[model samples]
Target chain A: MAETTAATKTVKFIISRQDTPESKPYTEEFEIPYRPNMNVISGLMEIQRNPLKADGTKTSPVCWDSNCLEEVCGACSMVINGKPRQACSALVDKLEQPIRLEPMRTFPVVRDLVINRERMFGALKKVKAWIPIDGTYDLGPGPRMAETKRQWAYELSKCMTCGVCLESCPNVNDRNSFIGPAAISQVRLFNAHPTGEMNKEERLEALMTDGGIEGCGNSQNCVRSCPKGIPLTTSIAAMNKDTTKHLFKKWLGM
Target chain B: MKGNSYFARKLHSLLGIIPLGGFIVVHGLANYQAFERGPEGFAKGVGLINGLPLLPLLEVVMIYLPLLFHGIYGLYVAYQSNSNTGRFKYGRNWAFTAQRITGVITFVFVFWHVYQTRLQVYMGKITHEELGSTMHHIASSPVFFALYVIGVLAAVFHFSNGLWAFLISWGITIGPKAQRVSSYICMGVFVIVSALFILSLVAFRGDEFNEVASAAIALLGNIG
Candidate 1:
């Protein structure tokens, strides 16, 4: 009798749905049979399988983008229960009743739960958030960094470009071209590397441009909302000081 | 994109904290003289500023130019950013929005304030010594009084909050603990400065200056 009762238990979800890139968004509710330790992605999958609303009407399968089922991928990030986080890690049992899911609207929504993260990528490109190393020849062991520096750099390197930080950021919305915190942290990571230090001035100059370090209003939501716990504000503050020095260097024609 | 250069962005933030912020602090203290030493003291403070060497040049270089650059560039920056405090109600997020809002209010208030007072003096309509009476007259109007109150409060908030932001952006307070401590200090500055402005307003309120002037005259008569 206990087993039967447990089997009959259900979990409900209200998902914000958009049919096309330009279409208006709407919400659809679904009720799925509860399973122990079920996550939001699994619940979404159940909806995809049935494609039915709570009132028993047939509907299109809910569309979302995901690759790695793990939280590391950051592909399944959405507004789960009004908090921007990964759906893969948001367990049904853990969230409040009638779980609500919506796309991170900081980026333009493509459809349903998928959003175009091109802005974030564009910022990464603008900031040159990478180490330019030639792969043509066999370069030997790279320059070494102190363990203390390397440890913190590793923490910053954990960023997955998930766009959660940007979503949580109030300054990174449609009107502002602020590059957001993730890319700023990425700049810090690469600039700290011994190989990447060669282009330190270049990276600093890139950050000194429009939509760069100056655009940050220092709201500090990015640090709290980052899934990997990257020290975003610290990186921003560091970059802020570096960019000012770069400005002075340019002024002195150094 | 027009004012979006590296130098432009950096200068905007720098001007906000430097000469512009310095001017605000000086101006607030000068106004506070009204409460501390009454009308004569406030006039003396204004007279000292006006009596400075190369007064026009000082105003143009330190006050006007920086104010123009900071104000225009600030408007451009504010236009570029959007506020999302409704969805993200974090304390910092709210501060972010409040900074912009207060900046805009301060801009408008500064324009009207300069027009009403300094412009009148510049136009040779009123002497600098009469500024106290002028202020009393302006405060006598309920609408202008309310506007000045809002404007002064907004300016105070903008300066205080901008100070905290300036510290972080300049990397003076990088760690979370340091940033939190700086926030408290900035808030204290805001409260103290705001109280000073309010006291100044109260000292200027509706014909109270007349009573103070009469009291001063009586004291002078006794001295004579």
Candidate 2:
């Protein structure tokens, strides 16, 4: 029987790197020791430890953003193998070798795999994607929601603001001011809430503004690209109806 | 730049489905009459449309104005968006890009078509009876034939895919199942309409219409 050596088992990565946000991006290759069930994040961590290029030259460690190693936290979202997905959950064994790691270009690159997600956050704020609750002192028992409504609401609530949906969207480029599907879905999520209903009209009105719901090109990419499988396009369609109704109401002085 | 108002976007989608889309379907079916009844049937259909009372008003309101708004606003919307099919190569993303690209090609082609056919008629350079022969004159050339072929395909795609997008945008087809069904239906519409339009083009291919075209040109020369 032939003996299998661990030294021969290695994973290759072609990482796009930028030393600074203002600097140009370039690719660097690295070969890391392969481990069973390893992920892109694990490979990145290995690169961080060794800081060696594939050609045996010493180099700076690759930069990326991550918090929870699991997929819940959206910080580690990047283009892995040309798909915008969570780096934490991308298994090396499942991925074809020479794994490509690049920052999601929809946003401005902070450096390497880390991108500035301020545009997404700005969109979230524009839509007021939260239930406004004032007074810190013991506000007991907010309004209850029906079980079915809560079930779907929980699904919408799973959006980690990871910017994957935006990254995959065509309308969310530098020239366009479209708020994107993620923020629009958040509007639907908050609008469905019992307490969030208080600001429902406000949210709808905000969506009627520039870069709001009108920005959606109905590309339907957000729903497909969402790692959490959030029904983003459904929310957009619903909001399209709501915003139209709101516009009619505003015209009628209702 | 600030985007269109919510009402404007709604109107854009609405106008596309209504007067414009309705006009394409009607015009396509009218042209399909040529396949069964030859060029004379197509001429009669054109004459019928021309014979309507206050025809210019109807043309401006139902066709020209709505087309202008939809086309110009569509151009604006297309300009404001970017295509990311290179990164996210989903079916819907590709359809999105196709919709925009076809919109542009259709816009240019529609303008040329109107100028060649309708404007000439309005200017009294050609009569309604000469419509089939004029179309034959245009289509007999390899270059114009290629242009019409591409233009017709683009128009068919734009209208069909725009129908699907309209259903989703208006919240008519919210779920994946409904969207899938509507997509297949729209594809059927595209194939049928495109076949009919191409058939009409082919109907005008022979030299039989050239005699009528020669007479029309002779009349124009005398008037000039």
Candidate 3:
């Protein structure tokens, strides 16, 4: 009788499903046997295994993405009960039921819970978010960074391009071309490097254009929603100052 | 498309604080004379401003142009924001949304205010000395009185919140702690400055202000 009671306990999920890239999205409820410590991804895996609605109707297996079930990969990001976050880190016990999952509408949904992050990657490319280093041959020992500078820079280096910041940001959406906070912070990271400083003006120039740094409305959602706890607002403020100085320098013919 | 809003956007921020925001501070303090010294004192403050050399040029260059750009560009900025604060519900997020909402309210209030006062004076409907009496008449109606209260509160909020954003955007307050502290300071500005405007509104509605102000206006007209 005790074993049956354990078996009967279940967790319910309401998943927003889009059958194809162009399909009309719908919500489907599923009940899975409750486990001691199941994350949203593990519950999703259970749904994939059974592919049955809570009403006992047969359905197609839910399609999603997950790699490195830890939070670092950022591949398992979705709207877990209205807040966009990494599903792998959103534990069943901690979340309010019935747990709801939806694809981040900031990006286009490719299939159920799977969004195309092309725009996010496109934004990174627009801002030159990485150092342009060729690793074909060995170079001399890199320019030394101050220990104090590296201490804070290390915090910013944790960004995994998870798209969480973009989803949470009010400035980044379909209507506008805001490069979003992630890419801007990455620009700050790369520019602080001794060699990366060479391209500093070019990067700042990129931010001075359309869909660039000017788009930020200071809603500051990116900092609060960042799973990596990166100081996104700090970077934005720094870049804002940098961009303003750059504009003045241009006017002065500097 | 690579758009360069860099300069225009920066100008909007700069103008908000410099001449436009500066004007709000002066305007609030000037109106406070109504509360502090009754009708006679309020007219004296208005006279001092009008007596300034190059007053028309100063008003046009420092106040009107900057106000036009900031108000119109602000409307565009507000419309561009597509995010809702309901889900996030963070303090900064709510402040962000409230800033945009108050901006629109303030614009309407400012236009209506200018039309009723400055425009009327320009049209010779009232003299500088009669300004106190005009305000009393306007403030006498319950409907207009309520509108003035909401409008004053909203405009004050917009100025205080915009000051906070101006500090961050210009890189003065970079850390979370610094930003948090400035938020408090700006709120202090909002409360104190709001009191000045509200007190002036109450003074405008009082019987003493109307009677004394009308007599003063008549005496001034005879001397002129």
DockQ of each: 0.63, 0.68, 0.72
lDDT of 3 by residue, A25-123 (tens): 999999998989999999999999999999999999899888998899899999999999999999999999999999998898999999988877888
Candidate 2: regions farther than 4 A off: A1-6, A136-140, B1-4, B214-224
DockQ-better candidate, 1 vs 2: 2
Q: Which of 1 and 2 is ahead in lDDT?
A: 2
Model 3, B56-133: lDDT tens digits are 899899988999999998898888787478789988899888898999999999999999999898999777777888
What lDDT does each candidate get? 0.86, 0.89, 0.89
* TM-scores, one per candidate: 0.93, 0.94, 0.95
Candidate 2, residue B62: Cα displacement in angstroms equals 2.3
What would the per-residue lDDT of candidate 1 be over residues A25-70, giving only the tens digit for each residue? Answer: 9999999989899999999999998998999999999999888888
- Candidates ranked by TM-score, best first? 3, 2, 1
Measured as a fraction from 0 to 1, the native contacts recovered by model 1 come to 0.71
* Residues forming the 10-long window of minimal summed lDDT in candidate 3 chain B: B1-10
- Show model 1 residue runs off by greater than 4 Å: A1-7, B206-208, B211-224
Model 2 superposed RMSD (Cα): 2.2
The TM-score, computed over Cα atoms with residue i paired to residue i, of candidate 3 is 0.95
Colliding pairs, model 3: A210-B3
lDDT of 2 by residue, A148-172 (tens): 9999989999999999888888888
lDDT (Cα, tens digit) per residue for candidate 1, span B1-224: 67556678777777888988788788889989999988878888999999999988998899889888988888877887777777677899898989988999999999999998999989987667767877887777898889999999999999999999999878788888889999999999899888888788878874756665456557667988
Q: Which run of 10 residues does model 1 chain A get worst, by summed lDDT?
A: A169-178
